[model samples]
Target: MAELFQIAGAGDPRLRDYTDLRDVSLRKLLETERGLYIAEGEKVVRRAVEAGHRPRSLLLAPRWMESLADVLEATDAPCYVLDEKTIEQVTGFHVHRGALAAMERPEPLSPETVLASARRVLVAEDLVDHTNIGAVMRNVAALGFDAVLLSPRCADPLYRRSVKVAMGAVFSLPYARIEDWYAAPDLLREHGFTSYAMSLAADSVPLDAIEIAPGERVAVIVGSEGPGLTEHWQQAADHRVTIPMAAGIDSLNVAASTAIACWHFRPR
Candidate 1:
């Protein structure tokens, strides 16, 4: 049987969570009775469904409603079918992704637990751009890295744009944020993993030269693109590794660098 939704016009109080002028802070929703982060696009929403994230509700253009039958059937949440203009007005940004979902953030993973069974992990420090963060996670997942550790300054992996850009790999990958960035390397050491900082310093060993022993656990730390790894992280790392590139190129984007580093350190 097809369910029905009586159109709740834009500005209806019940739809407050969906209306926005500025970027709706997912954290802001946590303050109110209904706390949810927005998940955009068809694929991401599908991934969320497959990941067992129940949607509180959905907002989408009328054209998208019929196309997303499988997704709707997977959940009992209300689907607010609207026209494109209505979606644009309510979301503040143009609703290019066609469908959006309101989903609660899942319980975060513990750093120790995320790394418990890992042989290789990727550690990101203060990589703020959502696209870069997503790309990094996608690369990490595709290239055989086992887990991800993030600094406090790293953007939320669950952010809608991040999720979309990552093609939902963020949901599949194991990740946890290190509470104190300064103590992160020590934590890796305590976990019996060797920390290698990815930086471009002349003293740094080339990525290809850093050999890994069989059964040895390793963590690759990538800092923000411009500053590379901080001095404290460098001091804490067992070694500093750099990608060998042409002389004219100053550096690779953090995402590109991450892909290369992760592949080299991937478990054989």
Candidate 2:
């Protein structure tokens, strides 16, 4: 077992990193020498561990020491126990969950590599919200999508809030970014995938109208919330699909739409 440390006051410099709370980009976190991200709550940490993310350390309120003993014993990472008041002060808010972990970021898989053998993939274009990114990954995992592809502007799937909201699914799902968005569909096509762009344009076909061939490679392209598919992408796709919606509801949330699309196109 590694050494255990105790935090009794917010004045300790050791808690500096945990302070300065603001949204931090995944790129910024990755660039850090420590190569770490904060994952909060026992459930998220446990799921992250189960998904194979390496933990650097665990921080907990003094009350959780015995309850989380098994996890502490299982790794060489140091465990730090802090008083409730200090934890709140250092973290900038009260955390009733009582546990958190810092984990190392793994090497990213390339989009081409992630798509090489996939039968189905979800392509995200500039979906910058961490919550939506997390929700999309959860959908992909639930509905059997093989991988996720992100355009250059998409949110980082490994962001702390995303990891927590995804219930740690971010650690389990295979994903990668494509630097050139326009060229990716062509590459996917060359690799035997038929691209389907999701949108609400008049020319778009209802998902029910298409016959998805079994064993054929397919990729679904989804744009951000406000702008649907880019005109160039829509023109380039083999087909355009739209979900049927009730009157007065402009459209589903991008995450909801992603889930429906994944379920519709899941492998038979």
Candidate 3:
């Protein structure tokens, strides 16, 4: 059972894990160095724990204590109770959800290990926006895609804001970061996946037109929101593809585009 401690001030050293949450650079550096990630809100916290992530500790307001009672009871980590004012002071923002948890980051899966069991995969390249990454992860989990492959520069799906926005889909979805961007295209091909790079190039085929051969696997590659896919991936993909749009709109956000492509190429 988690031991409960009352916090009197924001300066308490024990609350270090939950500090400066609004400072992206600080949080990123701290989390990466310590191998810890924060889960915010009640649902995300529950989902993280249920997915087998061990919590280092939980921070909560008094009102939230009863709501997360089961979660706290399952671990021996300390639960630091603080008034809303003190929490705001330490985290640099009001935790409206009233609950937060610092969880030990789990080991990362390798591309080969993830792909071995996955048939339909979504690859995110240079997508640095955490919310977009999280939203795409939810789509990947809900749309029946088998796994996610991320480029070296993609945002961390385990980031606090990302995890909350994903509603914990990050926990259930198997994902890996590709270190060698140059080899990624060939690697997917060797796995027998028909890779389609979502792009705006004139020669790009409509997403619906991609042929799915018998026993053929599929991979959808989505690029960053602003610049879209880099020239390297656009040229390397088996086919450059685009979602046919109507009216004046020529493009959609990566998150929206991903859903349409996932549904179009869903394993049939």
Candidate 4:
């Protein structure tokens, strides 16, 4: 069972991991340097732990302790008990879910490793919004896609906001960064997967019109929020695909478009 330490103030040094939760830049630096990520809410925390992530510690409001008792009993990490007000002071927001845990970040999986057995994959290029990244992961996982591959410049899926928005979907899905972003499509092709770049190009075909052969490996690519897929990716991809939309609606949000594509290309 974990040791319980009552924390009276937000300034307690031991609560450093829980401090300034809303500051993206500081949190990124601290978490990256410390090899940690924060999992918010009871369910996300439990999912993170169950997914084999080691908890550095847990910060919980008194009322949440009983709900997460099983988690506490299973780990040796200390628990810092705090009141809602102090919790708010430390985390910079109202944690209505009443639970947060700092977890040891695992080593990233290699693109090759993630692709070795994946048949249906989603590729994200330069998606800077943590929310979109998280939503994409959730959509991919919920739709039964095999994995997600991100470009080198994509947002960190393990960021606190991404983890929270994903509702722990990041834990269940297999994903990795493609360091050589330019050659991503080539890599997919080398792995025997046909790449479909989601774009608004004149030559793009309606997503429903594309046919997938039985037992075929496939990859669907979505780009950054502002600019869609790059010219290089569009040219390199096996096909340029687009969702048919109403007049004047050029595109949907990246997350929404990805969900639609994932559903269409899901294994038959």
Sort order, TM-score high to low: 4, 3, 2, 1
On a 0 to 100 scale, what is the lDDT of residue 253 in model 3? 92
lDDT score for residue 163 of model 2: 79
Clash totals in order: 0, 0, 0, 0
lDDT of 4 by residue, 212-236 (tens): 9999999999989998888899899
lDDT sort, best first: 4, 3, 1, 2
Q: Model 1, poorest ten-residue lDDT window?
A: 24-33
Show where candidate 2 strays beyond 4 Å: 23-34
Q: What is the lDDT of every predicted structure here?
A: 0.83, 0.82, 0.93, 0.93
Error of 2 at 232 (Å): 2.1
Q: Can you give the TM-score per candidate against the true fold? A: 0.92, 0.92, 0.97, 0.98
lDDT of 3 at 121: 97
Provide the lDDT at 14 for model 4.
Answer: 99
Residue 235 CA displacement from its true place in model 3, Å: 1.9
Better of 2 and 4 by lDDT: 4
Per-residue lDDT of candidate 3, residues 33-94 (tens digit): 99999999999999999999999999999999998999998999999999988899999998
After the best TM-score superposition of candidate 4, give how far the Cα of residue 175 lies from its true spot, in angstroms: 0.6
Error of 1 at 113 (Å): 1.4
Give each prediction's root-mean-square deviation over alpha carbons.
Answer: 2.3, 2.1, 1.2, 0.8
Output candidate 2 Cα RMSD: 2.1
